[model samples]
Target: MGRWVLVAVAPAELVLIALLAAGVEVPAGVRATLGLLMIAVLLVEAGRWSRGYRRGRRRGLGRRAAATVAAAELVPPPVTTALRWEARVWTGLVRGLGRRPDIPPGAAAFTHHRAMRAVRWTFVGVLVVEVAAVHLLVPAGALRVTLLLVGLYSLVWVVGYVLGAGPVRPHLVTADRVVLRCGLTTRIEVPLAALADARPVRRSRDRTASRQLAGRTLHLVDNGGTSLDLDLRSAVTVPLPRGRSAEVDALRVWVDDAQAMARQVRAAAGIGPGAPAELPPGR
Candidate 1:
């Protein structure tokens, strides 16, 4: 946190110092724009943190089971185990059959690809600043390429939108025991047993019941020193899960089964849920 604070503050401080040292009057509009931009980013981040992804949240019965187990310390380990099994099976069934896009665990994995709108707006801002700045700094015809840049930027957004909804092609490769598959460059792969720890986070969003539905996230780690914090909801987006509803359910079941197996393997390997081994202790 301290490092991040310094990182953010240092750049602005240096930029301000340089401008003042050079005797260039700092423009009010630039300062205001930068301040507003930082505020907007901070607000968006706060909103996301408050409304976490929902893939990690267990289903209704699973939630009950968790509560039940948590409420009573008198409950034996065997009872707890049974509750976990039941919850896992029930949640697996629901997730498989819901036909929703499975989200990947990492925050970056989920938001980066899907945020083309934000990127588009950013490009627009850049183009506006560039054109304005160029017009002021250079004589006519020197900024002749502004129109070309505008067209190119416009084309980028159109192409991104078209591809964003279309069928995605995955490029898969193997790196040692891990398989790497890229869907918009999101990768997920690790040996079945090498997964040393797993942690699940539940999120939901509801508006009418004064509730909000959030998504789930699973943080994972492997013994081979690979780790990923993924949101399952983000990972599962696309092509409506081919075939009939049953097929979709089957896919979901398969995914849940894989999750459970990975969790079990982590437990057996003495890995806890949540933090991956490779990550630093306080993260």
Candidate 2:
């Protein structure tokens, strides 16, 4: 749990207790209305996210690829799990302090969808402005406006969560060459001879805490694009080996074994070394 939430709990509890002492009551109808509102908000947001994901898939996703992406979108952030674990540890620590400590709720990872994060934040800023205006200039009707703002925030918040949970599928295929299909827009082939190296890119929230990270990475100029243009994070790279056999290594072993067979065919036909080999054309 965050420090801010923990600190607020004490005052929030005290405020509730004071309200009870003063005979303040919240109507049951209002509680039911809020519950229904939240349910509606979640369903609408989920629908919108599903629609966008489907459109991406329908344009060209493979069956297995579509399923993989769908599943990622469905799960909540893993940080939420970490926050729950944090709560259990803190509970035990505070138990030894003599005071009866109330336990704090765990934190959950909430993600903003890749494309929607900007729009969501902008909506939040607008809500903040509306809230400020209501409180400062129209205080008499602020209660209703505040409730309306809360409902709108809840709707947008669920949209952000759905985007965070949406599916992501990246392709890595190993054949005679390496083939990578990204999103619906790119198709890449890397000849093994031109491949220079493969290593994992290490990622950490704080750089100093971890020394080593591992994942697949490949380095090759490819038919086009720089090494930086490819998704190297969680990717692998293979560099061409050096020696007298380098050219043959790229043509026969790296590009395709069929190229070697075609070379043999050309030699048998009394063709010179300068002849174009009957190898499959590059895409």
Candidate 3:
């Protein structure tokens, strides 16, 4: 965890270390530019983290609802409730547009379907704007053809998001296995029989490994922080981002109410409670 945290801040750390080493040799202007760039990166990452918190709070209504699990403390209950409403609206859209995917029986779904609505709508806006431009701005030329292709790609992007996110089948927490989906491509399944221990991960924890692994991890999180860590009894086969699979035993996930999840998994798998289940620090 410490290593990943350091990794997340490495860019600025390396730059500052280099600046200190260079001292009088480096131009003052260059030093200032590097400093500003580092600051900007830090600021951007911080904003992203905060936004994820907001998105989380806005995800579900009740405390047990998926969104509130991780974000229960980040925002006011009222605000969080409002955010949940926002997420519900997206789910509504998904249902209205097509048949809602059959969720697993006796399971719960943890999703950012509401948070993803913006992207889905953004793609729609792009498709509309680009198609309008193809006909209105460019009249019968190479540029028009280019614009047409761009418009088609925009349509494709919207279709992809809808097809990927609209399905309710991917995010399921059942008595036996846990399935987490990212878009359409990445899917992770953790079965009870092969399980060992589940631990709560602090939200403040850095996501260096999570970022590096990205879609390959069983991440159902809006924030890229560690909310839960699962230690496998043995290596399990899971799908990676690019139509591939990897055998992994140590799986990190960002989800709501990680403590509750940890408890649930431990209980279901017959693992003793109060045992140290945390992943090795900096691993």
Candidate 4:
């Protein structure tokens, strides 16, 4: 029922918004009716979501997992996940200003930002130039305003992406687990006991996806390449966007210092010879 309402009303709402943005006047009665209908839909969906959320919690799911399940009950999981990703990007911009990595005590941080810094900044520069050009060349009117707004929003997204790939997210190796991250959206955690091997390898590809899964292997690429490969003792669950997950037996990741990272992981996990006696503190 909620899905039907959303499917029916969402397009109309979008059309209304676009009309308003384009300076096309809409009747007050029509606008008010649409508004009330939208509000009713939201209220109904909210109630449904609350009930679903409680049921999920009662089933022993974590807070985030429960919320995601509840949201999926109201709308498609991908839509909810996309909305959350956008929110993360916006918040990441503010968090990036602090220039602090999400490192914890007794964990070692391995950063991959350097590999993509130049590319990210270059893209951002291009966006700025494009925005400026559009603003100057476009005439004053609804179209111009819409284009300008879109350009500005694109600029913000790029900036957020840059930040998300940098200090806001970094790979961490704790005493018992290895936490691999790409930007603010993707995270994969593998227990030390599950690590079979760690090696330094360079694998470059012509793809723009930050995260990719092929068969039982997951790739977390930066700057179009990966530098380290991890082999797990058994398949472990890796979470993907839109409430999807994969049973991964191996992982390929990009980091600024792949050799060092490999060494640290092997040492901590007692995988190779001359393993360290104790885990090092966060860097």
Q: Say which candidate scores most in TM-score.
A: 4
Model 2 lDDT per residue over 1-283, tens place:
2223323443455555454555668566754655565555556546655665686589788766765565445444454344443444444234423333221233111111233346655775776666566556655553555555665655444433322222111222233334432221223455433332232222222222111122232222211211121221122333222211111112111111223333333333333556333332331
Question: How does candidate 3 fare on TM-score?
Answer: 0.48
Better model by lDDT: candidate 2 vs candidate 3: 3
- Against the true structure, what is each candidate's TM-score? 0.22, 0.21, 0.48, 0.79
Q: What is the lDDT of candidate 1?
A: 0.37
- Which residue window of length 10 is worst by lDDT in model 2? 243-252
Angstrom error of the Cα, residue 45, model 2: value is 2.4
What are the per-residue Cα lDDT tens digits for candidate 3 across 1-283?
3223334455555756654654525667766776676676656656655565566657644434544343343344455545554554456346546766647668766543553466667878877876887778777755566567767765755554565554443456788887766544356778887777878775543443332344334444544465677777766887654345667766776655667777777777778886654444443
lDDT of each: 0.37, 0.37, 0.60, 0.84
Question: Model 2, stretches more than 4 Å misplaced?
Answer: 1-27, 67-208, 212-283
Residue 104, model 3: Cα distance from true site in angstroms: 2.6
lDDT of 4 by residue, 1-283 (tens): 6767876798899889998878899999999999999999988888898999999999999999999898877876556666778988877787787776568899999988986688778989999999999989998888888899889998998788688768778899999999998877777889998887788899996887878888878899887889998988777998875578989888999998999999889888888655323322320
Model 4 scores a C-alpha lDDT of 0.84
- lDDT, model 3, position 265: 73
- Candidate 3: the clashing residue pairs are 1-282, 58-83, 58-84, 69-257
* Model 1 misplaced regions, further than 4 Å: 1-120, 128-143, 146-188, 201-283
| Candidate 4's TM-score | 0.79
